[model samples]
Target: MKKLLTLSLSFVLASTLFIGTANFAHAAKAPAQPAVSAVAKTVKQSKSYSMILSALAQNDVIGQFDPTEITANEVGALINKVTQENPQVLYYKSANVWSNGKIEFAYSLPADVMKKNRVALDAKVKKVVASINKPGLSELDKVKAVHDYLVLNTEYDYANLQKNTIPADSYTAHGALLGGVAVCDGYTKAAQLLLNKLGIENHYVIGQIGDGLHSWNQVKLNDNYYFMDVTWNDPVPNRPGIIAYDYFLVTSNQLRKDHSWIEKNWAVATDKRYSYLQTGKTAAK
Candidate 1:
């Protein structure tokens, strides 16, 4: 009778342990999946030269700075002309057009500057591009996806801004993701680059905000313009304890209060119907 009782007690103890293990497994949380929008699409891989030409052609005035007018030497200097033998990327310099003697087209990095920063920038671009599985995404959705990703990944590094070593435009998406910190300009430019890759229309606006120079983005979504400030959305790096969204999705008036921009820098819509918020106040006739 004592031996029978011992066996029964052992079986009860084993049953209790098994029940505890099942409860713990059920309570564990799963990893969060990336929240992709309906509009996200995959980016097509293009040859280096093709990508450069495509960017140039898509610019507002390619005819003004005709490629044909440029000499072979100038073309070679401006474009690396990627070949099998020379796998390394090349830098291109801005040239003068017939009418506008020294027209500054798109921004260019000097050969030395490119050489110094190329490795860092390339690694950053590759990583950020690889993060999203952009397949069959619409233009508007692509912009939103990038905007969301930036806000979620990067935090504002106010100390970096204080040092003035890193600007808002300097941070690429990859850097922001890996480092979790960036200045305002870096946040804006990184978002712009990724959105452009997805064929979304966006503009980088640099201007004075309050007393200091600042940078932000104006993206065209569904035929309307909306402002996004990723830097302000992320947590302040030095003060990670706090998070702010004062500037995430702001209206023109709100932006105008703190940010004054040169009219030429922005592609202001003529109709005013495309403005994000209407106050019933019209521009001077």
Candidate 2:
């Protein structure tokens, strides 16, 4: 799911890609904006990042900025940065940037659904973390705890994907954690949130699998980086008590055979000490 095009009149630019969800839906050009007394600052400026994050958490549109701070082509990069860096920010699906200095992000779920479900989602996250994290657990063990939990507990949303009626929650942590059904983005976001809460260093990754866009994660364990794809590890039929570790903790050479991503965008994953295939083990206790 990717789109990059420029409009003649409004100079509208929308970049929408949430992997298997929405399938690169287009964002219409917004109406003209009212004048502001002062130009808005870039998100990199002190305090501006937090303000924008807060607005995004509430599914609000952020306008009144200097369009020069972010051009149309750069909007997609910004959206990815925000979601990847801040795992808790799970609802944004795409971004719309106009030459008139207005920008808005489209969310996977509606504003009302987000408001109604966010609290419950937060609670579920805390509960799951509490249940799995224990004293004296190693970092590797913590990572495995998250990976195993997602693979064993959540069912892939194959029905919706086939029917093209995927609910917005299916693209979010809420669906993976609460609804127990999710696609690639949902599984990745849920893993990102869980790993962050467990004090693990990880980042969500975007890339291509065959012709379709996909989402996964990269983790730093024992000072070595590795990629983990919880979605793929969970089989499509979703057999009970079965978890596949084929995609767990693999290095760049191993993953590149099947996965393709922009090298410059992510950290190079070359270490294999923690790879499940090589060690036949994921963690110690």
Candidate 3:
């Protein structure tokens, strides 16, 4: 993975290969398994989640990859994996229509709109990165920079959730980068994308947070790994101009107080060097 980290956590309820009319919410309401667990077998076709994401990244609905031994449940897990990995690719609606193990991945946006939005999305990410990014900033500073930009620029789309009109784009990095409105998935993916631009290593950590499945990031700092949930740090109900560090840069032990995930799959995050609270970077709550 070239030391490039890509991870995002979302509620496990969204594991199915959701197909629906036009709204992200509609597709999300379908049946799903817990995050990181086996993907529900929605399609009998063979495909790798990683390969499907690569094709989608190029805006090609049709894509090919070696038919791996990975099972359908694994492919299903890619629903969240692909979403987190390619935070910027928003046109992915579903994966159906396979011939000879070649997938015709269905996209939410039309060909023209996909191209147009992709261009716009690319431009927006560059502009945003250029504006907040500065020379000679440390890794911690870079993390904070990205965190601040997202919290300041974007607002949680409570209205969309209430109206049930949430666009599919809102479920992606573009949602936070362009629309300035997203739920936890958009927020977490946007953070990872910006971190990748700064050459940071991280992973999407999926698990149960309280009563629902929520997504967050496992970020690296000073050659040590730590957990950060930007979505949790950013308060909702349109606080307008406040960013909380309560959930910023925490240890696995600290994180386990509320959030939960499979521990065996990831490195044991025992380092507290960058923990905002433990390091006295921020006042303890």
On lDDT, the leading prediction is: 2
lDDT of 3 by residue, 1-285 (tens): 112112122232242221112112211222153454222233433346657667878778676544454433345455545655556666565554333445556666688888877888889878877876788888889888888788777786667766666666766688788889877777887888888877888776666654455667888888787888777665555666766676678888987887777776556678876654533222212
Count the clashes in each prediction: 16, 0, 7
53-136 in candidate 2: lDDT tens per residue? Answer: 666667785632334455555444444445455656656655565556456666666788787788888899999999889998
Q: Which of 1 and 2 is ahead in TM-score? A: 2
C-alpha root-mean-square deviation, each candidate = 24.7, 8.7, 8.8
**Poorly placed runs, candidate 2 (over 4 Å):** 1-48, 62-73, 93-102, 105-108, 276-285
CA lDDT, every prediction?
Answer: 0.43, 0.65, 0.63
On the 0 to 100 scale, the lDDT of residue 281 in model 1 is 25
Candidate 2, residue 96: Cα displacement in angstroms equals 4.8
TM-score of candidate 2 against the unseen true structure: 0.76
